[model samples]
Target: MSKDTSRVRLTAGRVEAFTCPAGKAQAFLWDTEAPSLLLRATPTGRKTYAFESRLNGATVRISIGTASDWSLDTARKRAAELKQLIDRGEDPRELEKAKASHKAAAKAAATAHALTVGDLWPDYLETGKPKRRDAWKPRYLEDLKRMSAPGGEPKKRGKGTTRPGPIYPLLALALVDISEDALKEWHDNEARASKHQAARALMMFRGFLRWCATKPKYRGLVDNEAGRAPAILENLPSMKRRTDALEAAQVAGWWAGVEQLNNRTASVYLRALLLTGARREEMAGLKWADVDFQWRKLTIADKVEATRTIPLTPYMAQLLATLPRVNEWVFASTKTLSMAVYNAKRRERDATQAGRTAPAGEVSTVSESGRMSDPRSQHAKALLSAGIEGLTIHGLRRSFSLLGEAAGAPAGAIAQVMGHKPSATAEGYRPRSVDALRPFLTQIEAHVLALAGVQFDAQVEPGKLRVISAQ
Candidate 1:
């Protein structure tokens, strides 16, 4: 049949027969049935179906598929669709690109929806910082990790695998699926085990969700209000304010119990807490550099500021001066059996590696972070010995405030020494200098000593602990 050289009625036989000219790199045969439909052939016998059209005065070429994949009828129909798009003032290439982009976005959304709290926990822990602080405190950071930790690992101190943390179950849930219903159920389950711990875990998890809301990639997936749902809030246990502290009458017995303790450092540390009204952690974190023997002042790490300087009374100075200078810490824990064993193993390893005996007296003098930790049990023992009940280590701090007032010290002086933030009040809102606080502190210490029926000369040299009476 007569036909144009480059165009012809395409058929199964003609399609198979298409091939590039020997000298040409490629050739095309346009379908007469569909103007833009054509079969392209390379010299190597590779073939494909393609559509070509012009839009905005530029040619748009799109590969339909290979000859094996696109049937003659199917490729022609696709070519017809492309022509209709071009007629409607739409570029087929642009429409195809838009479809591809939409498909990719949908896929990304699906991926985000499948993300679990566990997936982003590491990133959150690394980047999430508390308000008013540059980074998480070491202790609070440890709490975060412990709250989310999976169970089945051996306990650090006791036998048996540790229980999963309160926040552990929620880690497996998809971020988007952490709805109010999900959280309510989670809180209900965890509260059954420990309401306070569950409440703490919920608080921590909410911080994580708030962090997620700040991130562009995770913002859409997290529901910040889910953690604050009324259902969860209603189930939370009522928080009770602690008012437990030593009464004036309990001082003598408590002092006697604390004095008889085997741990000399702890006995003095407990007394220091009562004498100075310092927080448990703040006093435990004291370093030698923070103490000023010459100035009779102590620079303690403050909750309200970077550090606070308080008058170091004669009694408190005597207590601290007697503590062993074992390390940098004023209340350093004694080296335990575990520490000795580990050090011995390490020394043996070093000797084996070097082919000689290790140096003498290489030992770790403290098991934990050089500072004293968890004196509650020891305090409990002393309380038991004294027949006192419900008095916490923090109770001693509260005791100081009450005793200091009974000593007739000004409210502001007591608050300043205890590192309390000053409030607007007639009682004394202004801060006090170290010298201004010294006499009041000394008065409070003398009052406490008399109430406990203990008499010791304040003029005695440091490192001397002499109690003439404990009646």
Candidate 2:
């Protein structure tokens, strides 16, 4: 019953009676029956069975089990085995440690075999970074999530409620089920509703499979090329690149209609798209610092490269000059304007009246992810207003290139302005100075404006700037 007792022989009754010393963190009592056996107690009086002995002239101790779990006889038997190890000059503690580790590894290997694609997906999304950029683009990341999204709530587009993510069917599947036959069936089933979307989703799923093959835990599970099965590839839709662009005669009217857009930022944004020939996102991320009226240049975020610079023409400058500096963007919409579009305020009000707190960190409806939402509806309206139609946003880029070509601007010059790969040798020879590139950009702007009949001299913008979805 005491730490130094001549070893009262260990019995169920004596074991139950042992208690930890009041001031010490742990207390132990050695059993006379098995000198190597110990009864250890924590300050809280909980006790466990353990064995202590010496090997290679050093004391080695190994825990057995709690008194509640191990009978005295069982503990004595374990002590005898440990004493044999000690007699052989082997550390029992080391052997105990190795045994525990081996058991753990065996359990882990079994669990790893059972891990599924769904199990690894969350980690993949968290650690995944795009090749072209530092992080995944919001919409693209969303597409990754969406293609594999679970089904529950009624969706915005469909009739009989929501469809499960295109990847959902494979989510619950075990890694062993990821075979060419499996992927082929999933593709064909998905292609029935929309071939293009299914094809795109398949591409993403394939990427996931490849990533899994690279991971040690999943390396054996995926075939890697399971997604590239000829059946799945052959089943995908034949996609043709879209060739939409603005016609020359539609410029003036399109420009006027976009100018008339009520939301000032959207107006400038639409006009900027046509004027700069920058991609939609490139224009959306335009920063005030990147725009320099003194030098007459606009450095835009470019997907191909990191960033690209193009001349800021007179009309484009005028359009920007009139815009409100809300945040960092040269063009930003008011929260009121954003809420009005998404009816976020109404939804928030409705949510408030229902005694529900807003969903935490819910995205603002105004900027569809820090940039203007799809301009299709409003753009279509503008086209209608101008008595024109069929001009996609990118069509403006095409329009700029074609218009520049017709106006005698060199292809390389226009290509450089549009942030193309610059295939023409003339592009390499084009002057690097902003002053050198100025005339080509100016002429292109002049031609587009003349066609659009939007003539204006550059005006001094107020020294203030605003922050918008320059995300």
Candidate 3:
């Protein structure tokens, strides 16, 4: 028995090989039944194991594990295993794949037990929230709270009972534990209650789960469970047709109703919404600095990035002039008298955070001590008082757009003034001057006032009209 000394060892400066017995070298090289192992050296002097065998009249070479872990005995055993598979007409590659898959499955199952939907939700929000233009973060958190099931009801009568929303039942389940059956059940139940809500909740959940798969801790858990949930059937109820915009005639009636509103701040806020074609929040959140009275321009900080400047019509300017300068807010709350109130108390904190400040005057209304009320709440009250039905502060903005278009404002001009993306045609031309939009905004305000039959000045008062309650 002689060692061929033709093979290289992975360790530096070591070489070993095997020489077949006489008449066996060629037989060993070409025979499918016999397994042979060799060692090779690279130009860099690194060594590696090379196992060779003949299968179906073709020679194949495979590297057993690296020399650091593959001792001679282990290498020989691996080679023997390959030889056995070849003899049995089975590929050694298939066996390796099967073993790998089994190991992966076992590891995934072990990790899945520790991974929950709650653990992966924040990562999903961080990734997906940037893609939407709306304020979806607060909405998403609200949905999460709704989806979180309550332990029990409250004890007091006036206190609201704590109950989990429809999606809450599944939040406690691990990502891998959420089977198709469970998801289908949740979907069916949510759809049965309110298909629109169910659809939205499912979409958020699916997005969260997809994001989970990208993270290291919850990767395999999401891959197997969340990815496998069945798609919800589209047999849910039809959605209500949203009155997103008002028609020419309806705009008149609605405006007429708005004019009858008695609340001074809400009236001004609603008028601003119509005059600027700004979203409810943007107008409600307006600070005095955002308004350039000298220029007659209102700068609206949009929900999306970028600020838009809308030319204030004479009517809107006059409306602004009517309000006392009790606070930094253009629409200061009468309740606080010092601070501006918007949407009543609910949004007071948000208003303050948005830089609400006391005006350079003593507080007169509501004991001169309390913070201002939210203008949005006051706007809602005014709308209700004016006998306006099914119209929100946002509707006032939509009405402005529709009326602006009706008044012959160009679509691009309307979109630009409304803080929408400029059309391709408009982008090619130089940005339109603020003066160019002045006539259109002026027309829109006049149209709204005419519809509401409002008399901004004593000279404009027509015959008296009876007001009716919306309720």
Candidate 4:
């Protein structure tokens, strides 16, 4: 052992040297008593802290922290700790390793504590909401509401029940708090009630966690939890293929049944779904502005990317011409119209009683003119009344796709009309223009209308059907 130069205070620009038979190295202790107090300098100018001291027939060494952060007090304190451990018959080297591990764990826990599921949800909404046209679809929003609270009770939005939104319950826990076991429990319980729904929830939750991992606050906590969660769906359940497509033979009978529907607006809405291959919500929420009569086109902002433009087949055009425009909505309600008229009447009476002249035509029976009805409740009631079995509003869009395919429309053209992403091969190519797609869309619309026995100008010449609309 080298003699201690107690008179000299270890400082920057000062180094102390010692030699042992084991190796010849110089210990450069920084001026401060910082954790990174010493550095071993080689004759070749390579510097490291590889110094060791033997205590009770065992070797012990300390790593003064890096030069940048070490202070004189910190280094001296660490050196004393190591010395005391050595004195107590503990291996200082083992003690150093244990201290390092505890520090690392504490640092990780601090980072985990800083992040919570609530913090990540807004980001998920900002990035993911664009994927949906109406971010709050009734069913999807309803699910979100259930997951927000502990018991899945519906929240009150003013006087009405708030719709559920996305984000599952387990996913809403703090990222650090979520463990593989918790996720497994949630998945198993959800699966018991509805396997397909559980599968969907897992997928959505996984996406949320993935977003969490990329954020600085939750980075380390998110990845491992998400990675460890078991795959909820080993395989998606197979759907039973239904041959529910309307046959040419059934066209006349279906039309007769549809015409007898008591709710004229619902009948028109269903026919529009079949005629234009528009999704039910798109047609139900159809506004007058979306219809371009001059261009013979109906433009719809779709759920996915881009707006879908379908040609207005002659039959569909004729149907539109006959309908009364009640409001901005294409299918406004009679009750709402009556309510508007009643309000106008009250206002007119107050004006007359106050000796003030009323504006002409302000109190007309057509007060709520040009608006449309909410198709959902009405459509359901109509379906029940018509005895239309195994049919849904969305089913019309699917039927349209199938019938279009059978009638020989290209898959890409059908997908574009249906607002689906183009297939990989098609995506590689330039997107087809509305004009380029017009002819195929016209054929599809004609085919669908024909399925409902609504004739158009295009004649389905036997061989021409194959050539004109090749699927």
Best by TM-score: 1
Put down candidate 2 lDDT per residue, 1-471, tens digits, no spaces.
Answer: 344434678888988988876777777888898999998888877899988877666667788999989999999999999898888878876777899999999898778767777987887787766555587766677788988888776765446667788888888887878889988888898888888888998888888887787787788777898888877777667776767777787787787787677766777788778766788878877877898977778898876567888877776776676664445556554553565445656777889999998554432434332445456677877889988766788887877778888878877777777777645435464535566667888888778877876544344453232322110
Taking all chains together, each candidate's TM-score versus the true structure is 0.71, 0.55, 0.57, 0.58
Candidate with better TM-score, 2 vs 4: 4
State the lDDT of candidate 4 residue by residue for 1-471, as single tens digits. 323212235554443242122354443433334332355544554444323456778555666564335544555676666656666888866766899999998987886676677766666665544233546444454455455434434553235454333234563577777666667777777667777766667666766676666667666676545424445344445555655555555544555556566666666666777766776666766777888767777778675544677666556665665454556666666665566567777878999999999666432445445444355565556555545666656666777777778778887777777776655324353467777777887787677655555543443321122222211
| lDDT (10s digit) by residue, model 3, range 20-48 | 33543321112122236655444343445
Model 4 alpha-carbon miss at residue 424, Å? 7.7
Comparison by TM-score, 1 against 4, better one: 1
Q: Rate the local accuracy (lDDT) of all candidates.
A: 0.86, 0.75, 0.61, 0.59
Q: Number of clashes in every candidate structure?
A: 0, 8, 18, 37
Please give, for residues 437-460, the per-residue lDDT of candidate 1 as tens digits: 899999999999998898888889
Task: Using lDDT, give the best candidate's number.
Answer: 1
